[model samples]
Structures are given as structure tokens and as C-alpha cells.
Target: MINSNSRSVAALVALLVATAMPAFAQPPASPAVPAAAVTSDAGVSGTAGSSRDAARARRKANRQLVKRVAAVLARTRGLDSSRILIRAADGTVTLSGTVPDNMQIPLAVNAAQQVAGVTVLRNQLRIGMRME
Candidate 1:
């Protein structure tokens, strides 16, 4: 009976140690990622930078087109270029605001279309014909 009680106590102690070992153990370290692997072939950062650059270039080109179209309209005879408003986006030009006469609407649209880099032209000009 004495020998059996000693064995039972030893087994209980072993069981307690087994359960406590994990609480004292250190966590496993995470694997490190290589720099080359992280940046391999058009990674997220690289692609985003390139896309931003492309967007900037497109915006610059559109601004240039707006200037060119505005210059053409300014040079056109019998058209009040000051009253005409020009906006360009993605090579598309929008001509808006009041023109002195109805004939100037087509003139302005044609002038904008003749300019290079104009993919689309939207004419929103209204004639403010004077009664006087």
C-alpha cells in the first residue's frame, strides 16, 4: 500500500510538469522575407508609382490640349474667346458658357476638334443674343 501511494504521487507530479512545460516555453520565431522576394517583378509599390506617373502625364497632356484649343478659338475671327470656357480631361474637351451668337457654337466645336490630342469634344455653349 505504501509503495502504491508513492507511485500515484509520482504520476500526479509528472502530469503537472507536463502541463506546465508549455507555459515556460518560448514562442517560435517568424520566418524573415527576403528583400528581392518582396520586390519581385512589378510589386504593389512599383506599380502604384508608375500608375501615379501615368495619371500625372495624362493630366499634363490634357492641360496642353486645353491651351491649344483655347488658342485656336482665340485666333478665330468674330468669336469672343473670353466668354468661352474650356475644360479638358483624358483628351476630351468641354467648351461651355455663353457665346455672342448661335453660329459661334459650331465654330468653337470645330476649332477644338481641329486641335491635336482631342479625343472627344463636348459643346455646351448657349447663345446670349442681345436685344440691342
Candidate 2:
């Protein structure tokens, strides 16, 4: 002889309790991962050493090319070798510093281009005022 509203409330509470009971219960334990299945660090040193050696060889070749470009520029006519700064990387030569006249700029570039290993030439020379 309960009121219908009260009956509905009681049924709702029972349903909620039944649904939440499993959520509060402890779950079954899972097996641990096997050690053999875990990933390992391999070939770490060999890969690093090979890259280092390749970089070293590249730098050595760049240094030799720089020397060759500088020597050629020093021997070019109408250019002051002492006033020019030369730097090379990966077969590219960079010429910087001030020269006595604007004509020396092209002269320097031409000399660097004549070198066997030069792939690019960068001219950064400035023409200084004539000395009396």
C-alpha cells in the first residue's frame, strides 16, 4: 500500500546501488610483462662514431680547400693579400675585409673561382679611401 512516487524513488535507488557495486569492487590482477619482451638500446656507439668520423673528414677537406683559395687570391695581381680575409666551407669561399680600390673586388672573386675545389664565391670586400 505504498504511494507510487515513493515506489519509483525506491526502485531508482536500488538500480543505482546495483550498477555502482561492481565499480567499487577490486579488479582481477594482470600478469607482469616479460623481461625478454622489453626493448633494448643497441648499436648506440657504432652509429655515433661513424657520424663523428664523417664530420671530421668533411672538415679536413674544407680546410684544404680554404688554403687553396687563399693561396690563389694572394698571388692575384692588383690585389692586396694581407688586406683580404678568406674563409671556406663545403667548397664555398667567402672574401671579406677592405681593399685599396673597387677593382680588387672582382679580381679577388676571379682568383677564388679559379681554384679547383671552389663551388661558390662570396665577395664582401669594401673599397677604402686612397692613401696619400
Candidate 3:
């Protein structure tokens, strides 16, 4: 049996390491979590039999990237208010669904292009398709 003092110290060290490791704390989140997992009402269409918790976390991270892309487009190109939808898979952002106009599409693509952690931009956007 170990001494109580030494055991406590070991536990404390473990906690410190866990907390200090930002990479461990912020692993890749889900692809459907929405702008800020804690806030966005976005839902996941994850693969069957997948862990809900893991999927949600993954989506949350993707949503954050989507949010940044949207913000960048909105500020730089004035196009975030459109119907363009964005999703991320391991830093590759795919813009899909629909948008307001042809101009908005490229603007959105370029916006996603500028964001950090974005490896590529896949435009699945159908120009002029209503997103109702």
C-alpha cells in the first residue's frame, strides 16, 4: 500500500498534466456540433453505432471552424448572411447546401480558405438552390 501523502501528490501531478496539455483538452471535435457546441442548436447526422459524445465533441470543433469561416467571409466579402452552409472534416471545410448568389459562393470559399487549420475547401454549394 502506498502512503496517503505520496498518493495525493501523484494524483495532483496527473491532474496538472492533463490540464496543462491544451492539445489533449482540445482534440478534434465533431462535424455537426455547430458554431459553439455549448450554444448552437445544430444536430449531428453521424454514422450509425457511433459514440454520441465523441460525435458531438467532433461536431463542436467543426462548428467553430465553420463559424470562423462565416465571420471571415462576412467581414471581408460581406457574404455570411447568405444561405451557404459549411462543414469541416479534420480541417477540410466543405461548403455545401445553397447560397444567395454566384458571388457569395466564391466569397464563402475564399473565406474558408483563409482560416487557420483549414487544409482544403470543398464547394458542394448548389448555386441558387433555396435552403428552406
Candidate 4:
């Protein structure tokens, strides 16, 4: 006659073998994904490419804003823009570097502010002689 402990051991072994059998079995073959559905780069999808393009476009727009502001300052009478440096991001513009005349500082700021697409203006200009 089979003892209770021996029967319990036999049942536990059978349960373990039943559960572990699936781990050794080969998995079912999966359908291949179409080439058009796959992205150029591994682990990256189409959204990453679109976002990269968007970031590039934003940088280009910022550069264009800086050029327009610099042009405006250059065309402004009594304002010397040669010594000034302009930086733009989004709609914000930063005016840095030194101006020969104190009056030209306001002229630069005002002219930059009047230009379209300039939402914020940061004036880092100082009154000093132009270096070199």
C-alpha cells in the first residue's frame, strides 16, 4: 500500500513536471512583421523621426528670428550693431555684448522689441568701447 507521505511526494513531482514541461517546449512561430511597419532604426519608431524633424525646424526658426532682429538693429539709425550679439529661441530674443554709446542700448532694445515674433527681450548690453 502507498504511504500518505509517499503519495504526497509523488503528487508534488507530477505537478512540478506538468508545470515545467511548457518551459522546455518550443514556442509557436510568430507571423513576420511587414517591412513597411518596421522603422529604419532598431527600437525606434516613426514618432522619433517626426520629433527630430520638428526640433530641427524649431532651431531653423530661431536662427531666422535672430537674423531678422540683427537686421532691424543694423538698419536703426544711431544704433551700432557690429559689437552686439543676438540670440533667439522660440519667440524670446537675448541681446548681449557691449555698445559704444549708452543711448544706443535703448535703441537696440526698442528696435528688437518692435520686430514681429519677439515675445520676450533680454537686454544684456553694456556701455563700453568696442573690443577689436
Candidate 5:
């Protein structure tokens, strides 16, 4: 007893209602993440990132201080790069090697000490001694 146009309209309405029902009935939910998993992920990045950054900065600063101290020693009176050896451990400077004369020992020590990051200077310069 239904008209052809009426039947088509009813079919379209049914299709529309079927599609709209699911969307209106529920909103999309975020995937459920466990608290432990979230915390572990964050903790890994937290400590590692900060410590890595600090270590990089420290290494860079140490290299710069080494360069500056080496430059000073190279230009110092009676002191040459060959006669000077410098090792820096966490800002403590250790100077080794031989100079032309005994008095050059103090000059080498003073040169290393004046560097900005040099906290300790261990001078092991033995004048008139040669290393082969």
C-alpha cells in the first residue's frame, strides 16, 4: 500500500538514523594508559636528559680551560709546549715535564694557576732532566 516515493524516503531516513545513532550516543574515548607505564616513560627521559646535558657542558668547559692554559704556557718565558704537560681532572690542574732551568718550574706553576678553572696545580717539573 506504500507509494514508491514514500518507500525511498523511509529507507533514507532509516540509513541516516542508523549512522547518527552511534555518533550521538557515545563520544570517542582516549586509549586507557596504565599509571605505571606513563610514570616509567617520564622517569626515563627525566633523569637521563638532565644528567646528559650537564655532562656535555662540563666536558666543553674542561676542553676550553685546557686550551687556554696551554696557550698561556706556550707564550710564557722559558716555557715551551714540549717542556710542559698539563692534565686537568675536574678543574684540578697537574703540570709535569722538565724545563731548561729550576727557576722555570715556578713560572710554569704560576702560568697554570692563573687559568680560570684551575683549582689545583701539581707541578712535577724537574729541571735539567730529559725524558726519552
Candidate 6:
């Protein structure tokens, strides 16, 4: 009689486990992302691409301005551009690096200011040896 009771309890426990197995195997429902959220994400990606393109164009323009300024400085009388560095933004120019003579500092500033695209000039030139 005790053996039969033990067998019945074991069967009941097995049944409960068998019923619970399917619930554990199936995945729970996941909330779907909103359509507007997906659209905004795509828009943001496009904006980022356009922003990068704009930044690249600006850098190219700045480089062109620097080259123009450098050429002008090279053509100027008694100004050595070998040790001078030129950087340009929208319309602002920064002249850095070394010049052999103090007089050349003003010469560089004047030449850079005359460039068509240069609306502002920052003279950071120092009288020193060539910087490698």
C-alpha cells in the first residue's frame, strides 16, 4: 500500500513538471518599436551624412584659402614663407610658425589680410629658427 502511494505522488509531481515545461520554453511577448521612432532614426542618419559633407566642404575651402594666402606671401618682397604656417577658417586666417626677422611678421600679416577670403588675421609668428 505504501509503495502504491509513493508511485501516485511521483506521478503527480511529473504531471506538474510536464505542464510547466511549455511555458518556460516559449518566449515572452516583446514590445514593438514605434514607427515614428524608426523614422526619426533614419532621418538622424541622413542629417549626420549631410553634416559630414558640409564639414568636408568647409575644410576644403579653408585649405584653398590657406594656399592662396601662402602664394601671396611667397610673391611678397623680402618675406620668407619656408618657416611660416598658415591656417584658415570661414574667413579668419591664423599665421603661426617662425620668421627670421621681426619685420617679416608685419609683412606676413599684411599679405595674409589682403587675401580675398581673409576677413580676419591672427599673427602668431615668432622670430626664431626654422621649426622642423
Clashing pairs in 1: none
- Best of the candidates, TM-score: 4
> Least accurate stretch of 10 residues (summed lDDT) in model 4?
22-31
Q: Which candidate number maximizes lDDT?
A: 4
- lDDT agreement with native, every candidate: 0.75, 0.72, 0.66, 0.80, 0.69, 0.78
Once fitted onto the true fold, the runs of candidate 5 whose alpha carbons sit more than 4 angstroms away are 1-42, 128-132
**Could you tell me how far off, in angstroms, the CA of residue 91 lies in candidate 1 after the best superposition?**
1.8
By the lDDT metric, which is better: model 5 or model 6?
6
The predicted structure with the larger lDDT, 2 or 4, is: 4
Error of 1 at 128 (Å): 2.0
lDDT of 2 by residue, 10-58 (tens): 9877855754464356243223445553444475566556756876797
lDDT of 6 by residue, 1-132 (tens): 999999988987785576446446643322344554334476587866676687789889988998999999999999998878777878888787778889899998888888998998988677764423
**Winner of 4 and 6 under lDDT:** 4
lDDT tens string, model 4, 6-100? 99889877855754464356243223445665467756767667766877898899899999998999999998899788878789888877788
Residue 52, model 2: lDDT of 61
Model 4 TM-score, all chains together: 0.66
Sorted on lDDT, highest at the top, how do the candidates line up?
4, 6, 1, 2, 5, 3
The segments of candidate 6 whose C-alpha lies over 4 angstroms from its true place after superposition are 1-40, 130-132
- What tens-digit string does per-residue lDDT give for candidate 3 at 3-62? 998998898778556534643454453445454335323353343225556666777887
The 10-residue segment of model 1 with minimum total lDDT is 26-35
Find the 10 residues in a row with the least total lDDT in model 5: 26-35
- Worst lDDT run of 10 residues, candidate 3, spans 40-49
* Tens digits of per-residue lDDT for model 1, 64-114: 888899999999887887777787887778787777788888888888899
Task: Provide the global lDDT of candidate 3 against the true structure.
Answer: 0.66
